[model samples]
Target: MSDQDPDIWSGIEDLWAWLDSHSPGDGQQSLLLRMLKLSEEVGEVAEAVIGAMNRNPRKGASHTWEDVESELCDVVITALVALRTLTPDTREVFVRHLARVRERSLGPGPGPRPA
Candidate 1:
């Protein structure tokens, strides 16, 4: 992990904290709302990708690749924020889930032995 990775999580947590403070709520509704926010961000990513690719004939390259990249970053930040909202130990939860996914897809690895 890069030195800046931790800082990114810290920033996301700070943003989430600030938002939560301004709009106080907890439990099921809060979780649902956060998850819904992730979907909205994902939709924006799709829109940006389409615009970047000039897929819409009417728009005609209305957005650049940089816009797509920014939207993708938003999706990631939104996902992490949702996860943090769902659990205080967001890093641990994410690490464990990612490890499981890696193991399941790539098998146990000690320097990439053949499957």
Candidate 2:
């Protein structure tokens, strides 16, 4: 994997590139497929979190909150990569979708919120 800036955005791009190599952007694949992949990654995060919490008795467990955090970031980046892959116009779609979600959740807040 190519080294990029350590920001969340770059991490997302890295995951996207990895996904492109792995799956090659099949338009026939359902959104559910991507979502399932994202879910699997998140499940790994849950496992790590559980390990960090000492709920699981695994050998040589050095897991910490920071470890779980990076795993969570991995899950988020994987999900975003899937979204960006499925929707090429991701920025606009994300903006529009977030607007609709925010409206639904917050009862129509101020318009055009910053990223």
Candidate 3:
């Protein structure tokens, strides 16, 4: 959190612009494609995790933890890009939703103790 750090919203905006400009389809179709990209990124993450865990006998230890980490980044980037495609106010939308989620799980008040 410093002046040197790049703003995430700025990066999101830049990515949205780049994709929107290069996209072959119209707006609606492009948005749908972006949404589908999320699923693809998530699948990659799952594949990376499975490979790292050696969960698949046929491809034991095929991926390293670094690969899993990179895939996780891809999932985040894809999700953010999809959100940006859905709306121009991506930062506000994400922040409000995140606040609501945080409040629901860990609100301003404390919970009852275990009996």
For this target, which candidate reaches the highest TM-score against the unseen true structure? Answer: 3
Root-mean-square deviation per candidate: 3.6, 5.3, 5.3
Q: What is the TM-score of each candidate against the true structure?
A: 0.84, 0.66, 0.88
| 1 against 3, candidate with superior TM-score | 3
Clashing pairs in 2: none
Which run of 10 residues does model 2 get worst, by summed lDDT?
1-10
The digit string of per-residue lDDT tens for model 3 on 1-115 reads: 8999989889989988999999999999998999999999899989998999999999999999999999998888889999998888999999999988998998754666789
- Tell me how many residue pairs clash in candidate 1: 0
Off by over 4 Å in 3: 109-115
Model 3 Cα shift for residue 94 (angstroms): 0.7
Q: Which scores greater on lDDT, model 1 or model 3? A: 3
lDDT, each prediction:
0.86, 0.74, 0.91
Candidate 2 error regions (>4 Å):
1-18, 21-34, 59-62, 111-115
Ranking by TM-score: 3, 1, 2
Could you tell me how far off, in angstroms, the CA of residue 20 lies in candidate 2 after the best superposition?
2.4
Model 1, residue 111: C-alpha shift (Å): 7.2
The most accurate candidate by lDDT is 3
